[model samples]
Target: MTDTVADLIARSNRLGADPKNTNYAGGNTSAKGTATDPVTGQEVELLWVKGSGGDLGTLTGSGLAVLRLDRVRALTEVYPGLEQEDAMVAAFDYCLHGKGGAAPSIDTAMHGLVDAAHVDHLHPDAGIALATAADGEALTRDIFGDTVVWVPWRRPGFQLGLDIAAIKAAHPDAIGCILGGHGITAWGDTSAESEQRSLHIIDTAAAWIAEHSRPEPFGPPLPGYGALPPDERRARAAALAPTLRSLASHDRAVVGHFTDSDVVLDFLASSEHPRLAALGTSCPDHFLRTKVKPLVLDLPADAPLEEAAARLQELHAAYREDYQAYYDRHATPDSPAIRGADPLVVLVPGVGMFSYGKDKQTARVAGEFYVNAINVMRGAEGLSTYAPIDEAEKFRIEYWALEEAKLQRMPAPKPLATRIALVTGAASGIGKAIATRLAAEGACVVIADLDADKARAAAAELGSTDVAVGLAADVTDEAAVQAAVDACVLAFGGLDLVVNNAGLSLSKSLLDTTVADWDLQHAVMAKGSFLVSRAAAKVLIAQQLGGDVVYISSKNSVFAGPNNIAYSATKADQAHQVRLLAAELGEHGVKVNGINPDGVVRGSGIFAGGWGAKRAAVYGVPESELGAYYAQRTLLKREVLPEHVANAVFVLCSADLSHTTGLHVPVDAGVAAAFLR
Candidate 1:
């Protein structure tokens, strides 16, 4: 039930950590018991600090490493050499591991050297604004005076510890030390005191920078250079690199510089101050905090900065490409791959840095870091040179297997994933309507018809990119049906839905029906539907995306009409095929449905003439009477369009009717009901 020293240290670290703050790792802290054991009189155990990689936000009781103070002091004496320091650090870490503790941090030596019970370090951009300047030490003295001590940049281990010790010895009243090119280190009797001191130092430095630094002018330029070609722009960029590099080689300088002839020429050509060009950020670390860069556009030589910024979108595309390349190269293997590039920063000719991100949180962080870095470089009299990880290294991270796997595991888009559909007699009429509708709804539609030109035209009208294809074939031929469906899968990605809308109907009584008439009717309607559906189902079943076979049955399937023996019998056979398919494919996620439409008025030249004339003759009435006859039979009294049939097909193809398989949707105007009455 007793609280352990390890528990207290873990609690303190957790209370102080902030995961949202990227710069939190730059700070350090530690805690330990000060009293002796009541019964044994043994010194209470001490907890040494862990450094950077330790996220205090999630620190648990086991995270704290109990280090004997004597051992820590001995390790610090031998930590001057990098290799020796690493070895000693590893050895101490192993010792902690043996004691079931988290590995001790590399910065433990510095923490041990501090005299306070708790220590904290922070590398805030606001604080670094002063630390990165040429006369940063002098500036710190002027601002803080005797409140804090200042230390020059040194390798961060034993040397930093020794420097901190010397500074504290010289200024016994100092609350903390501002380590040059690094961050601030503060200490106190407790974690709160250390945290407050660190915050005070950052706030003080931020105030000083604000008071001393003048805001750089941004906005439109009068006018300057006009547009230039890519080659010339590249040459100009090369020409300016040396100057840019010279300006970048200062402390705390993360600079990005670019020269564009178009921007430069535009400003020069215009009446604006065309001589000024833009600058960008130089470091990736800056990108994590401030984004990439700013845009500096060239206005007329006499133009104001404000006007140039207003028209600054010209460079957006190029900046996005560069940002994408940087992200592609530098992203961690565990990070998501860039689908496309984004504009994180923009450079305007004659203007200062401008940072951007998709949201305010990212934008604010980027702006703070970028503006501070620009100030540090400008105050230092030049930009500091910093190298980012190379493209190859970045690519390795971007394409890491874990990230790829994570992305691949996401669910695919529905209604189109590997589903293929074929429309017969698609050159005109209900076939064309069905083909167009299927393609629009994401199914790959294959238009097969006797007219090659009409099939191709229908495919083009469907707006199917590559999913809708045209084939000139008589659907009745088994060989042609096989080839057509094969091509459908290849073109549309897969085969799943078959709208058996191709059919020919001839009116003939049993006495008048000849052998040729019977064969031809059966061939196109019964034979064609069977062949195409069979071929499609094979592929659909193989794909396992659930296959649908939709037979375009006529109202004749449910009614007996005069002089319609051959046509009526073929349609009945087609309807029966749907029932059989449903029974067979029910377990495979495939459904079979039929649309029994009374009359479809839309088709090619053939339907408007031959079929239309035949229907008129069969009804013993004018062709115009066809619509009224069908509408009068239905309950809704609505004239059925080809789209009505197409809509029914869509419902059958979807999962909404998954449980209602082997059914028929009467697209007719209640004609079956009229017949029953």
Candidate 2:
């Protein structure tokens, strides 16, 4: 062994002694040596690791062991049926019980699987901060790239060894493998280089995370989140195996590890914990090692393990009920099928992960992954928000034919290609009507309006269960416009169509029009449309999801309107805006168009004032005869309502209008073609 190994062992012992390393016992170190068995003429490469019951602070050379590397590898390959911890123990017993040497470290197999001459595993606080983040993988990839290979979280032992073997095969030149949700593993030709690499990776990742990621503030405990007892934890684990298998693979084996009833009860009794039962896995794959869901214990502080376990069973029943409710609300007949009762990974208030898998290694990976995911979720509460994969999308992946075929046979249709739409002024009038109609036809609608209350109420009336949300925003405000677009993603996942239906018009010719009037008209009718359409274009471009933008222009835009200079100018500008937006967003799969409507007067507060009487008098017609006069001017002579304009907007927003852009569709009852009567 090198002097660097001695230094690392000393440092490891100190770190284990610190109270901050409550979970440090979970890690270990090992070395390679040569040993000769007296009974046979066999020379073997010995892998010595820290013993299971020993702490690093007080560890001694006697605490380590010498095991045959070749034998260990052969045993792992042939007895893939053994559980991770069990396999490790069995391997240790085989080497020590008969031969008369100290037992090897629990991580002996992990050390043996690596190609490097030296290896070190540690779970530093800084490393955990990065590992527990939702974007941890991407961050790691950006930082390390091919320098490291990442194995999803799992339990420790024979299974982890297998995972390492696969990773080593894939990256023959990699310096080390970072176990997701667990800690960093560093390996190199020499012990010093391995330690240096491990330290550098952890420090670099920690600094980047600290600078880029905002930490969520710890809040008061929620009302009911707590830990559970061993018996209940075991039952929960067994129940979750089937569901976990469905999520990952039915052919995958399931195994359980780390169900300490005492630890669970102790965690629940801690005063410095959250109140609500926030159940989730440490990592995405952790569900495989630990069951998808754990039971939340809700007992008083200082409750005994037996009491907590009994209470946890009651809570488990409640969890099942709640899971059913969530399923009923979100699931459809076409939804993908899942195994087990619930898909949650960890019970709230529990510290360790319970993993399940087709085999021990896979199960360990699942457990480790679950632990990391849970930590990330907890850490992310305030810094940023996260939503799980969409229910429908989750179903598609879980019950996918290709994925299921690998395990068992199943039937389901591929997810249908669905359209998404964003409708401004959706609180009332044309916008609301259009939103309602589109949602009825199986489209996701994001309703944006200046009136927040009305928009929310409209969405509620339409059914909150539908993929729809009401966003309050002034479209003319660039920031607000961007936020609205983001809201579409945060709520409905993405954007496919934009309906610029919000506008304002004032009757004033050039001489009567004030700067304020022009500005106001421009703000809503021109600038507002520009802001909203621009934001939509950005999203569609990034996603490459072809989409449409429909501008609600006016008939006055093309034909002259007396005393309507501000209104008409803005309307004309809106038409031009469509042409410009279309040109820019076209290559990015977004099309822009406009709709000009005439004589459509339903629920417009614009027509409710004395201006209507003034208009009627100016035209030398009765107030009721105003409609008649406009009708006579058209060849069709039919009245138009807001619904007609909304219908026209829908057609332009639909895929039927694909390949059509920079055109204006007029819903005017043929008024533009009529000569003076």
Candidate 3:
């Protein structure tokens, strides 16, 4: 098959999807094509390369900037200076075919200089691990024989492009170039050859590491730090939420969330974790996401909660100073004046690691990057000292204008911006809609559900791991409820919104209502909510920032019908809790509200799960028309959607209804009977 721009992107995605090849969007790819110049009216060679910040896994034609090949190659002599990053940015922008598209990768010239139809520059962990080793060049030569050329570490731009071109000129048959202490670049006339070359190098380096690296043998799992035990870490994290979040935020607009995945905890537990983590990111390219280093904390299991919070604040101040010092000591005269915001990852001994991002997807990506860092760092340390490129190179990559351009490519923020949300029963139905709406509006949502697998599936559907987190928590279980709250706080820096949307209904009348029926309904909607609210309120109060706890009550709560005793009574009980808790939490700047939705049976799942056919029978309507039947009963005469319920929850948590708390809002297609009196 003829290699097209799409084919190039297809191979780039293969390399990007695996962290072993690239983590996040830390790689670039390009394809050579011919396009008709609008002005010249003649066919011209064009280079379509992955733009800066565009993830290869999701790259499309738009993400690949189009530049005239001759114009890009001419920069070798026409460009004013090699050392000026600003010059490189302007030159790349000026060479673009049009305005309105993404900025080309800083390595655009390098891709064009490859003298092949396809070019791929990847930051595979194994390749970087091998490249950063002490005798890297010699090892690279030994591993790839004469098929790959070795290029010493150099600032990425004019000089590096020129260097690669020279190597290809000197070694015409070379399949790739090993960028010592950095990454590797593979090129070929077709996508298959270029991808195969990249895979071969990564596989070769991974095999070498496997043969030589003898990792530290861990003892049987010891309980994590102090009498606190691992089970209590989530609550401790929740207790520490406000302070840690304050520490992570430079502007306090974004939230830093927590994850205690076994991977992070195992890294923390490993004997060599401290030394490995201190060495910084596995590759300098990763500094933009993981930050230069993580802030490490050791909390005494039995330490006073207030004391721990205060101590963390002090430590974070120290971390900022240390980060600034590191910058001052290594930053060159040409480096960016602004220090990037606070560290994206934090480590707490006995607890686990926390990763921060502007949103949910960004946070999860940052967290997962650190997990990959741990793996690479561990392997490198076990075999040899974990050595990445020099501090200067790391700062260059971290502060590089090209790297910052990726963030700038994104559209305007949604209303929630950096707010964090935790929604229970978020695996499907009404809860899922709430999570989706919150994330779409720029909130980092946590999918808290009884089904662990479904929660993860829900999280994955939201796009990036950073945008949504899935945690299995039975809300009725006090410990689990607290942990879910902690997970939200830890994952997003601090929690600002809570949606008590998880509930089950019995739909039984007074006489038919079994003891178990009443108990189960109350267990989830009432007791479960109490546990979550108590825990969440503590964190929000400590943050001193106004937040919302919007309970998903029911219209039936206000007007109970026949055979709806358990569900209606339980919902009504929680509806009262909303007013009472609202009054109480208002003193702490926390708003407690309720969303009473009815006839959302089709999508709410509460109605569809055995209740739909029964509800249709009661109303003497076909089950298929039950939603419409209920809709006509209301003043609006419109079917109440799950999204409508989600909107009501959003309003309760948002500035639109900011002044109203202890208020029960109805979202039941305008049910006059359910309206607040």
Candidate 4:
């Protein structure tokens, strides 16, 4: 029944990868095996544990930090009576079994002290729901018998490891131990055995909860708008999104996405939501993500969008004031003050719910965890009077230096981390450049194009991560355009930036321009831009977060060429579209701008679509020299690369342009003729 070292590693990855088990990398696992010391040529017992904040799902052997079992245990004894948490951490690090510098988990010592050969720790909801309740220990022993023991919450340190070891000595047959207000630690002789024991505990506890708990949820009134028609529902979302977004944001733009399904409504509609929600998170690790509590926003659905938005602005202000009050109540004179974040979750009765983050991924994760928190609280309350560790414990876990270590290793926030953007015609050329640039800056981007496969491929090319998603959307089709916006929200949580970059280019004299060419250009450029801008604006407004819509227009909007009537005329319409949007959306705090880039033939699909030869011929230059000719035409004599246009979009979306809107910024390398007058 014994599992190999590699088997333990694989098992840990599989368990950690599932957020249902642990939201993000919040748990650790370890295995004991015999290995010869490379230098000493002597066999020793080694313990390999999940490193700090490492993702278990994709984890490999190297992801684990190896420590000598004797050495790990020796630290507690040699450093007995240690009072500070930092000293234990240093001792654990000092006992690393190998040359690798990867930090051992704070729980590494906890794992080492266990008697079993394999230990798998997790933060599964069901188990945590049972472990963190007011009657947690009583219920655990009742449901699990003597296979596990209860270890009261202790700020993790060397003392914690010693305590767990003492409990294990008392219950030698115990397969797991519940860490109060934290999680479960299940151990066995084999990887499968350990996982099976953990899952059994989770399932049995879930069953107990299901049988005993049926607490109902009741949200504040939403008015008749909750039963509004489909169009009305969409409209409702559009108007409300921006107000919440604005209230959540500070100096920079912030976005939000809704969780409005029956499940969410059930949580919001809970008659006891105010009391149940204040019950705190079912798991301790969530303190870092969800905070101690969620901010609830209740707005009447029937209120005019503007009025509701205005009310939200007021409520959010009060929410911040209350948040500061909570912080001021809990802070100690000895510690540095912990800064508060915008509410991680919001509840709007009759409307729905939302989770906020710096960007789409973060928003989605927060939302997901909030829902899980609701479910756990419901289950716990339905069975027994539910209780979680108080505000004091939350502050301890959330501010614990060792616990925050994983987050400290995270890279600095990218400029657009909280923003979600969708770009039309993103499979190639300028659109592609913009999407890639946005992803690099930490925005979650969606690529929409007529070419479904190409769009997906382009998204894949950007990376395997969720930074970019692809959708096959014909911007000219109203339904397709709406679907694209929906897809962006589904993937990224909310939409903040909408780039109308999909357009058709044709080179023809006024007399030679075909009716078909003109219609096609208008459909994709003018009409497409209108469709996408309107759809995206709805989501942005619903988020209540000010946003940006950057149009990838052409220099022809200002300096029309003789033969390109189709492209020039439609581009002018696109340019005008920006002004119209800005005029309408400015009151909502959304900025609309245009980037007029010239000489974009290098990466533009226009060259591949036969425009290069035609435009070169029209300009009386060799086809190979067309790009050079455009560069020469620029006052700066610089090639107007797609990257230049992408940078212009960044600038337009940045806080630098927060005050400037409804204006065209030329990205054509200083073409004086195309300059905005």
Candidate 2 lDDT over residue span 374-426, tens digit each? 44444433233322323333333344333334345333311212455789988
Best-first order by TM-score? 4, 3, 2, 1
* Alpha-carbon shift of residue 303 in model 1 (angstroms): 73
Total colliding residue pairs, candidate 1: 81
Quality of model 1 by C-alpha lDDT: 0.59
- The digit string of per-residue lDDT tens for model 4 on 552-660 reads 9988998968788989999999999999999999987899999998968788887868988999998899988888899998888888888889999988887766898
Each candidate's TM vs. the true structure? 0.42, 0.43, 0.80, 0.86
Model 3, residue 394: displacement in angstroms?
A: 3.6
- Candidate 4 total steric clashes: 25
Estimate the TM-score for candidate 3.
Answer: 0.80
Error of 3 at 248 (Å): 2.6
Q: What is the lDDT of candidate 2?
A: 0.60
Q: Considering every candidate listed, which one attains the maximal TM-score?
A: 4
What lDDT tens digits, residue by residue, belong to model 1 across residues 282-397? 22235334433443443432344334423443444455567676676567655664644443333333322233332223333454555444434433322222222234433443
After superposition, candidate 1 runs with Cα above 4 Å error: 1-414, 604-609, 673-677
Clash number for each model? 81, 41, 14, 25
TM-score of 4: 0.86
